[model samples]
Target: MSRTIISSNVRSYFASLWTATLYHAIRQSNWIAIAVTGVFSLILFIAAEVSPTEGTWGISKASWLSVCGGVFASFLFLCIQSMLSALKATNRDMYKAAFNELVEKHGIKTVFSQRGSDDVITLYRKLLSSPRRRIWAIGMTNKHFVDQHLESLVHVLTSYQIDLVIAFWDPSTTLIVRQNGGRARSIIEAQSALEGNPGSKWGETIRQRQLRIANAVKDQPIRGDVRIVNVSSVTSFSCFIIDDDLFFFPFLANTDSTNDPTIYCAAEGSVGRSIIDHFTKLLQNSEVCTTTYHQKETTVVVPMT
Candidate 1:
């Protein structure tokens, strides 16, 4: 009972001390006070560094000062430049300017509102799911639209030889195990470790997803091939070319898919052709993915004997 009472008293004292300190801190907090304190602190720091005691440091005083001064000057310059840029043109203004430039250059016409996923889905179906379909697409390593909304449409493309330029990552060992089967994941992780980058498992699940699609393509009744090229780069946009129609989906950072804008361009237009050409360039730089395969089975019936 005595020990418990003492412990309670000790806690109460500390709580009171904290409360007093917080009260004083809040009372003293002011812009003028802060500025004055900062200036004095800077001055004291400078004096202490320059008026150093006799010490045999590796770097000479002059050389160290010169290097520190240079770093400070560079940092100051960058801060000033950033402030000027922000003042001159805000991020919103820059985005508007870029949008206007693109619109003017491409003579773009907004077909549908760039608002929701449904809008994009409607446009995709109208363009890609026609009786006669001709399409080429460039998208993220693991494209959600393709995986989620367009699964049924995917089987149709199995009859046509499609080209894919995917931005794939090196997946981590844990992720590989979670996604792929245990046996396959163990082998993959062991092989990856042997290559001297055990922790380099950036995009294993995405690669596996793409491989699944590739294998599915190979299984179609009409033999169709999807040539996958894996590139190591971050993509800010996804492009799909259906016949002469082009759809562009901008990747919005820190936003859900429902908020991201999907743009549609006519194939005969200059903007559409330019977008297609850009996708072609991306395709040219990617490394071919030759991991997935489809094994054909044969069945023979014996004559009545």
Candidate 2:
């Protein structure tokens, strides 16, 4: 009775261990390794069990079994490693596809070169040629951009109603200190460095330029609103959304917006829709001032709560 009890206990321990091990292996989805291991194990067992009455091909059963056993062990180890590699690769592919699936499908064009196939100015000209599209532009109200892409800008401004968001963060409080420490001088310093006596000339010059552009948009034959938003906290990415088409580029800490690589896509697609939604949210949350020029000039200042 004692011996039987001890035998049963030993069998139960092994049964549980085998069950756990098999469960873990299957759960890992190591099917190839498991299949190969089972087949090799069966072959090894057969070779060991067969007793050679006579030599076949001048090799004894003992030698045959020894060679087969070593080969089986090697193969089992290789299969397990292969299975791990396969799993890792599968996981990596999934994440890579999720993040860059749009880039792969739509293709990312670099606008680094002005004369290349990926030139942004050329692309802008091509995209903005559609007269039916509503244009939404968000960036620093830099006139240099307008001058460089004059033809495209003219087409867009004249073609349809243009919704423009100009950045209005205080230079002294925000960009001058945070982003352009040495490269940018304070208003006081710049005034003092002037050819004449120090005054509010620098500030006036900036205000005048901003007003000039706002007035230009207001005077256009097509109707649109020029809005000012504080984007110091949100982002420095410049975006140009032409109807369903969108082109965006990020401003690096020490680089120009024009030099940055622009990403373009149709706003109706998943990625584009998400981008459009985000833009709309930003607009909703940040309307510091708006000037409309449809029938007549109308300026509305949204008081910050």
Task: Compare the candidates by TM-score and give the number of the best one.
Answer: 2
lDDT of 1 at 46: 77
Model 1 misplaced stretches (Cα beyond 4 Å): 1-107, 111-116, 131-133, 158-202, 286-305
Q: What is the C-alpha lDDT of each candidate?
A: 0.51, 0.54
Off by over 4 Å in 2: 1-46, 49-59, 66-92, 95-97, 100-118, 157-237, 247-287, 290-305
Given candidate 2, what's the lDDT at residue 180? 46
| Top candidate when judged by lDDT against the true structure | 2
- CA lDDT, candidate 1, residue 48: 42
Q: Give me candidate 1's TM-score against the actual structure.
A: 0.44
Error of 2 at 138 (Å): 2.2
Candidate 2 has what TM-score?
A: 0.49
